[model samples]
Target: MAALGLSGCSSSEDGGVLTVAGSTTVMPIAEMAAEQFEEETGTKVLVSGLGSSAGIEAVQNGTADIATSSRGLTEAEAATDLVTTVVALDGIAVIVNDDNPVSGLTMDQLRSIYAGETTNWSEVGGDDLQILVVNRDEASGTREAFKKIVMDGTPFDRSAAVLPGTGQVRDVVSRTAGAIGYISIGFVASDFTSSTVKSLAIDGVAATEENVENGTYPVSRDLYFFTKGDPSGKVEDYIELVLSDEMSQTIRDAGYLPLSDASYQARAKAAGAEEGGDAS
Candidate 1:
């Protein structure tokens, strides 16, 4: 298997397109980054939104150059020469229909709701209506992350609607009355703005750049780009380019928080700080 994005970035490296797959939650940032990379370098970067597991699988099976993910690969997924790179921090937002009146949720409340214990909007200071739950499909890293943080290994309620992709989850919650879902902050479009559906603070903490950066937010995690082994050739070049200060700016605009100068500088300064470093 081939790995990419470190040390070997000769401008004259192969000009062919590199295939990437993973997290829909990371899709917007990946697309924008790829667009800029293509414009500046004239090399293609094709990204797919097939969830994190699929992306890791794609790399492990020799089908992709990079795998983008909002969650880290499971230990089982990183066997052999596979390498993992963390690119940015993402704040996971709890979303409900605009009609819902809740402004925040305690972590315990979130767990109860997703686990189907709190099934009424009234239970969380909303309209007295049955609460509808929308969830990401099993393959989603966002799903796993949400589960890991909120559910604590407890099973999600079988009755909760498990939808595919972040887009789908957003759509369902936006349309369904009393619906609630979790999505990346970036996807909270204008339609959701000023709507009855609003983002809820988790554990009394809001999901924001300030909160995420200071580690005040309860639902935040590193975003990733995975490859097989140490990156070399064009892969190394691209990953290096992404770690630049300019790229961190892109990270913030993509609705994730940028690593601080100190944080990013330390990361960049590390040896072999490719896509597979401890925190790429």
Candidate 2:
């Protein structure tokens, strides 16, 4: 299957196949944007989920046109003098077993739960049961977001269940009793029916699109696309395509909240610079 995909990518003529890499958290949106881009402009885009760090490496090496990231890279990335663009915003949501009675929680309570201090749900207003924690892999930006928000500057409990990816986190949480975890809104589907996992409110605010867009979601973050310095080629076009109206529409379709006005305007500026560079 990988071989076939490579072949397909190699066949593009509009501007040659544009290679992109990055976080699995942003892969679905990038993929959807690429599909619509090809449909509209006859250009092809090749996207890969190589982990965010690996994607940054790809851009630094000129191996990819763009690097989609859920979290910004470290200082080392900035030291390279690469150009970064904000393409979207996302709200990382805390998901719990639907049957669990506890709904909203303050960030402080979350920190206690993940720290293994608040073991009984009854302590948080739910039925008596041992607290079960599910976490994303360390490399994932989703995990980082959780750390910054829910963990309250503390580390996850060593006894917690750690999954390799967002999908795995979701799957495990959905089926496991007393499960609680976090995931990007995009991975959620209508039939994710384990019926076991549901979204929980953070700090008295609900985890809905409206809340995320309105800045009520405490865990909201900007999504980025990192590129090599002074983008001035087909690569630039590919990045610009990500902010197009159709691309924005796809984001809405993915069940994730759209970017706020400031985010949208910033992306527009970045796109203009990039696309214009390709022109000159």
Return the top candidate by TM-score: 1
**CA lDDT of each candidate?**
0.76, 0.73
| TM-score result, candidate 1 | 0.86
User: Where does model 1 exceed 4 Å of error?
Assistant: 1-15, 190-196, 263-280
TM-score of each: 0.86, 0.84
Q: What is the C-alpha RMSD of each candidate to the true structure, in Å?
A: 5.6, 5.5
lDDT of 2 at 88: 77
lDDT of 1 by residue, 1-280 (tens): 1323321231223546767678888877778778888898777777778888887777787677778888876777755677877777777889987766788989999999999999998887878899888988888999989988889988899998989887778777888888889988767664544433468888888877677666678887778888888888767777776766777778777777655457534534552355445535
Q: Return the lDDT, model 1, position 48.
A: 76
* Per-prediction tally of clashes: 10, 0
lDDT of 1: 0.76
